[model samples]
Target: MNHYRQIAPRSKEAGGQLFAQFEGDDTIIVEATPPKWCDRRNRYNFHPSRWLQQQEIRKRYSCGLHFVGDWHTHPEAAPQPSQEDYRNMQDCFNKSIHDLNRFIMIIVGYAEAPEGLHVTLIGQNSVQLMFCENNL
Candidate 1:
């Protein structure tokens, strides 16, 4: 996640989906796909290609990973979700067929871990912020 931060002057926004697995009471995030050439990126915004993301989801699911959520980067030190970001997340959660009750969204920012990461869970009827127990 840190590797995709927009730290450079010309770095465009970069992002991908998050994959995880449930173990006992824990939902451990196992992988994050890096931005691909099919994505549209600018200094202030990122637009991932849906077709490619779906392909990734299928491949990861075949490997035993579940499609847990989406992640992307922002140029700010501490990122916040833009209106478009919220809408996109909501749309994805609403349209996708999954057993989970919610989906996670992570916005990686220009600063280092925890602070630079805005983690949130978007449910059908609620949104909740999440915090890391340790420094990343």
Candidate 2:
């Protein structure tokens, strides 16, 4: 995830879906895809192509990976989800077919982790910030 941070001025916003595998009560994210060519990315925004994303979900699902979340990059030091970000994520939660109650959203900022990262869980009734361990 840190590899996709928009640290350089020329770097555009990049992002993709996150895939994970469930381990007892824990969700271990094993894949954080890089932005696809079909995705629309600028310094301020990342708009992943829904068709491509769905395709990825299907492919990963076949490999036993669960679609758990999405992630993107930002140009700032400490990235925060914009109102649009919240809306898009909520829209995904509402529209997608999934058994999970929520989906994670990760924003990677130009600075280093964990301060540079904005991690949140989006559910039907709530949006909650998540903390990262010191290992980051």
Candidate 3:
């Protein structure tokens, strides 16, 4: 997303949780909590502040906006999840208290691209890249 891109050109990765709400069967992302206090930062790695703050956000919104997924910048032409990325997603799925069956991962490539965004659906039983429609 443009928010990620604005910080991608620099020397480190930028990331945060994606906030959204469900409408019937659809999940519509409406907001995000930018990285506040990242514990680690580098071109290839990022470890954001743990999920503690996420709880505050959920309460602030009265649990209306859920932590649907995460978004980060990748310094490459194509965004691909690293082994660590997969691990993180798995951790998220296991400890999720919202009873989420699926979590999303949005990777934004560094290169200028017509479509720099790549989204993946990481469910309890499957990990798959999802087709996106440009309704944005």
Candidate 4:
């Protein structure tokens, strides 16, 4: 079974701050997209154009790195995956030709103090909390 790297609170904050990061050596590439959402509740947009731009920049910056998976924010306490989120992940997984290890989905919740923000990973059928880290 594959296990996810548990991201620490400080790393989660860093992930939130940078919002995105791409790192790789040769055989494998890792890229993470932090959650970015609109202010409106009903309209949940993940900013695809920005994500595309980030991919392009990564291609230019790193010779081997490529787009892998994405992340988004939920803006709720005790966040739970919504129907739309599930659908989107399904679409993403279906359209992807790479193996499961190459994909990742992260959801961040903007709650309150102490717990402040929480990160979760969306898999094919289940969800799991995740940990993040800074490459540099």
Measured on C-alpha atoms, candidate 1 has an lDDT of 0.88
**Clashing pairs in model 1, backbone N/Cα/C closer than 3 A:** none
Off by more than 4 A, model 4? 1-43, 50-62, 112-136
How would the candidate models be sorted by TM-score, starting from the highest? 2, 1, 3, 4
Pick out the ten consecutive residues of candidate 4 with the lowest summed lDDT: 1-10
Cα TM-score of candidate 4: 0.47
Predicted candidate 4: what Cα RMSD to the true structure?
9.6
| Error in Å for residue 72 of model 4 | 0.9
Better model by TM-score: candidate 2 vs candidate 3: 2
Judged by lDDT relative to the true structure, which candidate is superior, 1 or 3?
1
Q: Put down candidate 1 lDDT per residue, 15-128, tens digits, no spaces.
A: 999999999878899999999997999999888899999999999999999998999999988888887888888889999989888899999989888678888888776777
What TM-score goes with each of the models?
A: 0.93, 0.93, 0.81, 0.47
For 17-107, candidate 4 gives per-residue lDDT tens digits of 1223333443232445333352122233443454554555456446544445555554444344567766776666566554444345555
Writing each residue's lDDT as its tens digit, candidate 3 over 1-136 gives 6555533456577787888888998889997666666447777777887765566456746967877788887777666678788778877877777767789898877655545677888877678878332323
Q: Evaluate model 2: give its lDDT.
A: 0.88
Q: Which ten residues in a row have the lowest lDDT in candidate 2?
A: 127-136
